[model samples]
Structure formats: C-alpha cells, structure tokens
Target chain A: MITDRIAVDIKVPNQTRYLCLIGHIGENIARTLRNYSGDREKLAYDLNLVLTEAMANAIQHANEGDPDKEVHIEISIISQRLIIRVFDFGEGFDFKQYVRPGHPLDEHGRGIYLMHSIMDEISYQQTESGHVLKMIKDL
Target chain B: MNLQIEDKGAAVLMAVQEERLDAHNSGELKNHMLKLFEEGKNNLVVDLQAVRFVDSSGLGALVSGFKNASSRNGNLKLSGLQLQVKSMFELTRLHRVFEIYTDSDEALASFQQ
Candidate 1:
C-alpha cells in the first residue's frame, strides 16, 4: 500500500482532440492506485469522465475553442483522495448560478453536472493567470 | 467519426465504430445526424456496442439528434450501450428520455411498432 502522494501535471493545447489523450491518462492513473478498495474499473471510468468533461469545459467554453491558448491539468493522489485541477485562460462562469436543466432534452449543460456528480468536491476559482476548476474524489 | 450506417427501410441504424466518443469527434456525429434528418431520415437507431466510453459532448450530440427527430415528427433511439455508457445516461436522467434497446435489431423493431 502506498501512502505517499503521487501527482502529475500536464499542459495541452486548447483543442478538443486532446480530450481523449487526457482521459486515458486519468484512467490509467486511477487503475494504478494501490490503496483503493473500491472497483478500480469503475473508479477509472469515473475519473476519465470527470477529466474529459473538465477539459471540454475549459477548451470549449472557457477558451472558446482557441487553439492558440493552452489548458493546464494537474492530478494528484493524497490522503486517500484524488484531486484534479484544470486551468484555463478564459473568463470563468458563476458556479453558484449553475442549475441542472429541468428538461432532459437540453443538450448543452450536462458537462458541469457530470463533473459535480462524479467528484466528491468541485470548485471554480480565479487565479493570477486565469481560472481553475478543482475537483476531488475520495478513494 | 467512424460510423457504419445502414438504412433499414423503417429507420436508419448508425453503429458507432469508435471506442470512445468525446469532444474530439462528437461534432462530426452531431453534423451527420443533422444531415440524416435533412435527408428525410428522421428515425434513427444508434448502436453503441463498439463504444466503451462517452462523455458529455457525445451525450449532447445524441440529445441534439433526438430533438431534431422529435421536431420532425420522428424519433431517435439507442441500442447496445456498454455498462459505463449506460451509467452515464442514467446519471444525467437521459435514459428516461431516449428509448434504449439491448441490440440494434430490437431498436429497429421498435420503429415498426
């Protein structure tokens, strides 16, 4: 069993094409956790889903699909919890105003909802460079 | 955006050939489904047996297709969802919105009924 914190930082161009690569990285990281007692496959899938959604929000919504911009992602495991932070250069939205769409037919709002549902904690904050969306999950 | 499209007389079956459906190719899917609607083939069955992962963008594309089909007085159904993909639908409560089947055949038959 590993007790020390493990972390990785990645910076990718703000393009949708990189979402798959980041998602796979997150999945592989979850699969390698030595102390987690829950289902590894399920945890891996959830991590992949949250990371992909977070990156999509940054690339599409925050960065507005600007290929020139870049998104920063940091994943760390500490104290039996997984932490993920995604940073973008665009203006952040009002997290408090976010509401799950009442209609299931609405197509554009599920990304934030999915991240919140899968992660144990989620927050968006402004940084000196830009904005960062932080998410955590208990292992 | 690899899809195996088969016209089944009553409805069209579009089997996604990709393992993961995310932001990368979901736009292509949305455009293809929109084109099918424009071509007067509004009833569709999307088989996801080959897809193991789907993110919110992929779900959005399917929702967009469903809305377009509904607006045209047609329908869009789904079939062969893997476990993780199925869980995503349930999490977003989209499973209640779209008619799902165990296989493409069943989804096609639903169009007949």
Candidate 2:
C-alpha cells in the first residue's frame, strides 16, 4: 500500500449535467489507485456511484436545485482507504432517518441507501457555512 | 437523451443510446416512457445495452415506467444491462421486481409467450 496520501477537490455549479462528468472523474481516480487490492472495476463503479449519488443529493435536495449555488467535492486516498466528502450550502437533513424503501415499486428514495450500502462509513455533518456528507471505503 | 423507438407488434422497444443514465437525463427517459404509455403503447422492452451506468434516478425512471405499465395491464422489461448497471439493480433489490433479459430479442420474445 502506498503510504503517501492523495487528494482531489472540485467545485461545480449545482447542476445535474455535471454528475456524469464528476462520476467519471471519480472512476478514473479509483482506477489509478495502486494499492487497492479489491476488484479495480468494482471499485471504480462504487466510487462513481457514490460520487454521483452524493453530488445529486447535494445539488437537488440540499441546494434545492438552485443553479446559482455550488457544490464542493473532495476525494482522498489515505492508508489504503478512500474518503469522499460532498459539501452544499443549504439546510441539512438527518442522514440517520433514512432507510431503504420497503416497496419494490417505489420510484424514489434509493440514493442514500445505495451510498450507505457501498461505503464503509457514511455521515452528514453541519458546518458553519454549509453541510458535508462524508463517505469512506476500505480499499 | 437519445432513444431508438421501435414498434415490435407485441411490445415497443426503446433503446437508450447514452452510456450513463443518471440525474442529468433520467427525467427525459421518464418523460418518454410516460408519453409512450399515454399513446397506449405500454408493454415495453427497454434496451440498455449502451447504458454502462445507472444511478438511483435512472432506476427511479424505470420503476416509474414499470408502475405505469402495470397500471395499464401492460409490462415493462429491461434488457442488456451492463455489469455495473445490473449490480445497481441487484443492490437495490429491484432485480426481483423487473423482468430482465440478456438481450432485447429475448425480452421481446418473452412478451409473446
């Protein structure tokens, strides 16, 4: 495992169009990890999914789909672990209150569930300026 | 949001041409499916061979289409899911809800049977 930490921070307007681009960036970054022992493709997919989901939530729900606002994303690899943080300047919600939808036919409410399932640790914190969602996965 | 629409007699085949189906464009797919349902073409075989990734919004659009089809006594099936996209369905336990096939031909054939 590489001992040096690597990190990338990005800021983008709160727009859905950037979701795919940011997701691909996350996937490419995961693909570059030299010490990750898990399936590289799977890791790439997970990172992409989590990043997309997190960004979507920040852009849509937290930012209230306000294109004027901006969302911040930070991805870091440290000690064989991948950590992701997404920040949005809006009122935060309780992450613990969300659970997987029980109905198979439900058309929504799966983003947070997927993020929790894919990441080892997930939390939402309120900062002085905004809210941040943190997700960590052991690589 | 490019989709190739074909009338297969038994069902309609809508092939998504995008590689990623997420919050950005899932709304368009949902709107297209709703429009098809309004046109009385409910039984659908959505070909996702080109969709390499699908997030919750994309899944939600498919679920919305599935619900709309079921309400009309029709069906909405999926075909040609990439490994990552398939994993999303499985992860959400939606694989059990939607009839999935290896390809569009098989999905359309199932509609005939």
Looking at candidate 2 chain A, the ten consecutive residues that score lowest on lDDT are A93-102
Give the runs in model 1 whose Cα sits over 4 Å from its true position: A99-102
Stretches > 4 Å off in candidate 2: none
lDDT of each: 0.90, 0.91
Candidate 1 displacement at residue B17 in angstroms: 0.6
Q: What is the TM-score of chain B in candidate 2?
A: 0.99
TM-scores of the candidates are: 0.97, 0.97
In Å, residue A31's CA in model 1 sits off its true spot by: 0.9
Clashing pairs in 1: none
Query: Per-prediction RMSD in angstroms?
Result: 1.2, 1.1
